[model samples]
Target: MATILYARVSTSEQTLSHQQTQAEAAGFTFDHVLADHGVSGVAVKMKDRPEGRRLFDMLRPGDTLVVRWVDRLGRNYEDVTDTIREFMRRGVTIRTIINGMVFDGQAKDPMSAAVRDALVGFMAAMAQAQAEATKEAQKAGIAAAKAKGGEEGGVYRGRKPSFTADQVAAVRDLLGKGLGVAEVSRSTGLSRQTIYRIKDDPAGASKALEVWA
Candidate 1:
């Protein structure tokens, strides 16, 4: 059993470092860190993400799972509860950075169990509600922008670009030509880590490039 940290951000522009720092500051030492970038909790289920799947597979009995909040589990009340319960049933402990919430299946006392369950239910519901409100607010903003002839929307610059397709492709071509990752990085101005990733999984690299591009 291990201690695992799962961090997620809706956009690539947002880094997981902040969440990681919080978890570490809270005295959690993660043996593994799973992160999902550019994946929205409002639109994506926890078990559906690439990194999320690995979290489920890697977690074991007696292991502890940490997230920034209950929202990281899901954007819906039922979904969050179901996911948390499933992990608990498997003997995995769940903890959240916010409020230092802890949920474990090992709570044997009836009152303690009830209190924990109720807290989970309340927090999960609030997470879902917050996500819904955020979605509604975004829609309202978009509608208001349209009414204003897209002027307001145009004024709001979106997330910063993390990677580009041409850069990825250049790295791929260099790797295919037997160039070292460091050499590819020097040529394309991308990091050696990015080049190694492209070399390791060209298909996934292509998909990321397409989505980000």
Candidate 2:
């Protein structure tokens, strides 16, 4: 019965605020907002992310799940389709603001259902193709870097971390001390919502911290 907006930025340098602004412009009032900062859609599956996992637990039947695109659900075809279909089967309505596309499992008409299914398949395939292309591009870039010497190509110039190592360690310490998320947020400068996410999935938070390091 509520509208939820899920936004993701591959790096800390990238802002989810732009995505939020777009979602708001699309007339979606988010009752809950979940985001994954410094998380790559290509490497992290929806179910594997910190906030992403929480989303699966929080979404309910009749709730509207909005994302920037189908790609936000996954990095490839199979993952994207499977995730969306699973949500639909659970009676959750899925919508994409980018294309103004809506998918619902409650459709009773056979023809409409067929069309929707086909569209999902197409989008899923496109997502996979896009990922493949990006991988190839990265490989090519690395090769070029190697040719020029290890100066540019040795390090993967990937997503930037939202928090520094020191900050992450502090967050972990506060969480380990069993401080409430709100209290942890107040103690640290991080948002209370983000603190709740770290508390909910300490393992994922640890992995994220490793990535930061």
> How many residue pairs in model 1 have overlapping backbones?
0
Off by over 4 Å in 1: 150-213
Global lDDT of each candidate: 0.79, 0.78
TM-score of each: 0.71, 0.70
Q: What is the lDDT of residue 180 in candidate 1?
A: 68
List candidate 2 stretches off by more than 4 Å: 150-213
Candidate 2 global CA lDDT score: 0.78
Model 1, position 69, has a per-residue lDDT of: 90
What's model 1's TM-score?
Answer: 0.71
Worst 10 residues of 1 by lDDT: 153-162
Which tens-of-lDDT digit does each residue in 14-104 have in candidate 1?
5678889988998989899988765667667879887889988998999999998988777778878888998999999999998887898
